[model samples]
Target: MTRILRSQGFVTALGALVLALVAAIGYLVVFDPARKTVAYCAVMPDAVGLYPGNHVTALGIPIGTVNSVRPEGTGVRVDFEVQEDRALRGEVTATTVSDTLVADRDLAVLGEPGAAPWDRSTCITKTFTPKSISQTLQGFSQLAGQLTGGGNPGEQTRIRDSVVAFEAATSGTGPELNKLITDLGDALRAPDAAIGRIGGLLDSYSRLMSSIALNWDDIEIVLMQATEGIAFINELWSRVVQLIDSLLVILPWLNSIAREYGRPILGALDGALPGLRLLSANVAGLQQLVSMVPPIVQFFEEVIDPATGRPQLTYAAPKVALPRAEADRICAALNGLRPGHCDGAENGLSDVNLVSLVLGTVGAR
Candidate 1:
């Protein structure tokens, strides 16, 4: 063993073997294939400071490494691998963040773990790439140039003065600004219950809009009918206004008439009240009398001669044989005398002689 150790060739081979072992150890430490990891992807609008092999972090703690960064269409697709044990689980957002202006950006996985594991098929589409300080400053410079470039010098001066004043006003209020920011943050921080209510409200509003869209035709018909009804109401209102105007014009005449004759008219009505009451009480008799008027008018109309415009009288009598004594009695009674008090009783002639006059008249006819 002493001779082998002292040989120059053995010593050279031993040193080479030690170097090979060290290299293997370094390779295993650098790229351990046995370490389990979960693969994920993210698409970002911009990936300026991000590169392959960059650290992927969760809440600023390193948990993974970016596998690749490549352009896919209009976005940058970032493929990453996280330690399987520390895999991002639920709905999460990826944001590119940097520690400083010059520092390299990292892919930040933000959110707490949820019930389901992360879906490998889907990419993290919800990503934000905030503008770097240099980009922001460049944007401001461009804006300033644009404002000052126009020929309106007064406007340019005003804008510049405004910016200066704003800077001056905000320069020394650091504590107040901090307080304002804190308050704003507090105000924006919604509780779980509030968030749930907001979500429910949005869902209800969505359903309401859908319902309106579906019933748009019926709603349109209702609106049209309402419009027609309004027009009719407007016309009726105009008529009412005209009636009111007419009443206004006639009011003075009515008032004058009332002043001139109202007392006499009231007095007459008061005097006739008993008669009016009696008439009302005999309304049935009045109705019967009114009923007889039509037949009387008909009889008069039948008796009138249309050609001569005069009334014509006609009579028909039945002939009857009466005893002479009874006839004489009737004639005497018609003359306002008793039967025995006739002036010509033996000759059957009275002072008036109505029976003989009627017989003579009939005989002559």
Candidate 2:
């Protein structure tokens, strides 16, 4: 043992062994095959900035690396390995995202854990590559060209001239334009209510239009009738004009005649007005008189002789004489006096007073 320790060759061999063991340990720790990982392949339409050794991330966290990228038909297939703990599964999607405009792209895997884990046999069919900054700028340039009339010089010139003319026309309207913009902003600030009202209005308008469409035939008939009525009116217009002319021609003569006769007619009516009013005042008494006519005719019929058709007259002496005051009251009542006019007597003749008057008159005769 002492001889071996003193041997320089032995010391060199032992140091070499120790170094090899340390290197082996470091290799195992850094790239251990025991750590499980899942291999997956994704076919992307464009893998422009993606290359081998590119990081594969889940939600911006680096989880694996791209193993290879090669063209397959029209698209590029990307082979990657992800840590088994962060294993991607069914319906997984991959996107190449860049940290910045100048930075290399990363493969981002996105999906929730599914029933089946992904293997190399399972190729991710869904993948996206965002538009590059240059491409986006090129597209914007094309849009701007189109807005400015593209390659047509005449159109461009016309648009430019129109813009200039508009600017000239609106030269000093800054305040007005500002006010319009401010008012528009205010009007649109709470747009939900306005949008709801507009929606309701549109719905009502649609219903109205539908109703109008349904009643189109009736509306057409009404329009036709109105057209005919207008034509009829037009046809009568000349007659109306002629009638008006005739009236105009006769108006002076009518005026002259009215001046001559109107006064006398008015005067006569005025002269008779008092008598007419007096007659109207006694209307109730007149009604009472009219009601008495039927009874009078019936009485005359009862007294008439059938053979002669003439009323038969008879006289008899009174059984009892009526007092002068009672006779006066009876006479006043029979003369159609008002109820209160005949004091201590009814407005109508009583049976007793009527009999007494008749008997007394018969006796006097």
Candidate 3:
């Protein structure tokens, strides 16, 4: 009886061991920590504390763990084995976050999310959105450049201009500027000379000023009168502008004066050039006639005795035209009179005839 009991006990112990082994394997299949049940793909610049068999959690609940971490192009690819019921929505951010206490940055997530019913059986890889340190650093650097103005396109040009101008002003280049300082030093040393010169200048200026000040009342009255006259003139000018604009024909008249009359008057002066030449020759001859008078009479009486009728004097032959109305009109026009009006006054033919004036003014070598 004792042997049979021992045998039964041995069989039961063996059966229990088999059952525990089967249970462990079934537990591993259904909730395998490394099998990537309901897996998700996350990208990270570096593999965040995640490696094969690293634990994962959702809302502090142990949901799954990392199954595999592999290099993926520029970044690393990580696979997480999440629980069947755990939810990971689009809004959730996956990043490698760190704490001062932690030796390495941890693979973490935020934004509590929902999962699909079909996601339990196979790997439903929703990409985990991760924070980029490089992008953050780039943004910070760009912002710093903008704030300092040193990175502004033309800021360096402005700084260069200011520095160059400062250097130029401090450098001495001109004699007048050097002498100005020298003169100031001398004047400060010789106070008497400076004071005497200043006094003399001031006295002269004072006398002139006194003369002006003595007539201050009259000056003020004249100034007031001038101001009134100016006001009247401005008012008149304004009215005249209105009237002129109303009479638009005046604009064409002014245009014609500039185009036609202005050039022709200069041409008219050129046309009268021959007459001017003749007048100059006449004046020169008149001067010669006066100088030769005494010599001529003596020659006539001495060389050709009129008492013997032996051709005492040979008359100087000449044909002179009398001044006609047309010639006078031309002369008057040349003399700067109204084109056709000439009273033949002294101004018409004076000590300075038209030819002498024209030749002196316009015909100089």
Candidate 4:
């Protein structure tokens, strides 16, 4: 028994047993039964960041690993293994996508129902390679530089000035930017936000596309009507252009006329209004006064001499003398005084005592 125990062979067997126990423990702890059912898929070898042991995911869940990448035909063949629990089926597409901005990549499998299943024998006919983060950033930088006219020294100065201006404009926006980021985080963390929004957007886009497809004829009719309206607008614009040109030609003469007569015309216009208002106010009385003028003019025209065609005037004395008492009363009445109070009435106011008296004569010139 002592000899058996001291044998190096026994020690080796015991060491092997210890290793077997540890291996069994590890197997129990880490092994997944799902991974035992392996599947293969091919991808282009030149795809960026693709390597063995990179995860394969479907529906954003990790379900497989890249087994090997090797040359196959002119392109590359990527062998990948998927867990049994996550069925690798349908018209699946394995696309390489970045897990982070630092160039880490993974294979994303797109799966659908009612399609063929994939296994070790199945070949992935299509694969997509995404742009690396560095490349994307470089492209953005180039675009920004181009937009700022970056080329030589002068262009660089302009770019620097533009950057400085931009910085100045955005200097006060730190708080707003923080708030924006916080709001964005909250939005992204909301339940089903990204997926639901994308789904709704896709559904709306699909509806829009379908509507356009179905109503193309109506859309065409609308376009035709718009074209006709545009044509009419074009013609109206042409007429307006011609009218403006004609006005331009006449404008200098109109300006000269205005400069010469502007004050006089304005003064006349200002003065005429008051006279017009006065005429309006006395319109009825003036109409009555005007009615008497025609008759008086006609009478004067009849009294004119037929040969000389001139107006005449005459003065005559009374044919018989009034009684002395009657004459005194008539003189008092004519003098507008009491009957016996006229001093001149007693004198010879009618004292042409001769039986016939000569009177003054007036006639046409």
The best candidate in terms of lDDT: 1
Candidate 4 per-residue lDDT over residues 244-271, each given as its tens digit: 9999989988899889998999999999
Per-residue CA lDDT of model 3 for 1-365, tens digit only, reads 67865798878988999999999999998777454356676766667455677666654455666777898787787777566556565455565544443344445654444533333233333334334566678889887665556567766476568789988997766788789999999989999997899999999999999999999999999987998899999999999999989779878888888787978888899999998898677767777758868998887677776578576545542322324535565555555732322334343331224334444457442
Candidate 4 regions exceeding 4 Å error are 6-12, 32-38, 52-55, 58-62, 71-75, 97-106, 110-126, 133-137, 152-365
Question: Candidates sorted by lDDT, descending order?
Answer: 1, 2, 4, 3
Q: Residue 56 of model 4: what lDDT?
A: 86
Off by over 4 Å in 3: 1-4, 7-36, 97-106, 112-365
Residue-level error in angstroms, candidate 1, position 293: 66
Give the count of colliding residue pairs in each prediction: 0, 0, 0, 1
Candidate with the larger lDDT of 2 and 3 = 2
lDDT for 275 in candidate 4 is 92
lDDT of 1 by residue, 38-92 (tens): 9999999999889998999998888899999999999999999998888777787
Tell me the tens digit of each residue's lDDT in model 2 across 1-365. 99989999999999999999999999999767578888889999899888898899988998999999999988999999988888886668999998787778999999767557665686898889999889999999998887778888766776678889999999999999999999899888978888999999999999999999999999999997998899889889989999999999899888987899989988999999999898667777877868878999988887998899887976653333335557566646544533322234234332333444444445632
Clashes of 1: 0
Q: What is the number of residue pairs that collide in model 3? A: 0
Candidate 2, residue 68: lDDT: 97
* Candidate 2 regions with alpha-carbon error over 4 angstroms: 1-33, 100-103, 113-120, 157-279, 285-365
Highest-TM-score candidate: 2
Query: TM-scores for all candidates?
Result: 0.40, 0.43, 0.27, 0.35
